[model samples]
Target: MSSHVYVAFDLGAESGRAVAGIYDGQKLELKTLHRFPNTPLRLPDALTWNVLRQYAEILQGIALAV
Candidate 1:
């Protein structure tokens, strides 16, 4: 049997996480690969979501997947 892998990212109000789904010939499984805090970045002009940091964390999760 062979296995397939999939990754998903979830960004929420308080936090963000990366999840992995593994499917074999007959079964599927889910696991949380990484998690990070989602906070607003306070810039001089306006507040924004820390997207760059989130992106980095997502990459980290992908690295761990394989």
Candidate 2:
């Protein structure tokens, strides 16, 4: 038996992406589903992630993976 793993999100401070990996042998095959800009915004000495946009991207990635 074998298993495949799909990553739907990777939100970094400057960037984010969705990656997929196939595990069958000693070597693993990787694939990218989506890559987008994920820069944090700073205003009034506060920083935050665009949660709405991020969630939309994540859903898109999941749809693509499926």
User: Considering only N, C-alpha and C atoms within 3 Å, which residue pairs clash in candidate 2?
Assistant: none
Off by over 4 Å in 2: 1-5, 25-27, 41-45
Expressed as tens digits, the lDDT of each residue in 1-66 for candidate 1 is: 889999999999789999999999788899999998989899999989998988898899999898
Per-residue lDDT of 1-64 in model 2, one digit per residue for the tens?
5767756578988888998886775668889989988866667989898888888888888887
Local distance difference test scores for all models: 0.91, 0.81
Overall local distance difference test of candidate 1: 0.91
Write down the TM-score of every candidate: 0.90, 0.72
Weakest lDDT window of 10 consecutive positions for candidate 1? 49-58
The weakest ten consecutive residues by lDDT in model 2 span 1-10
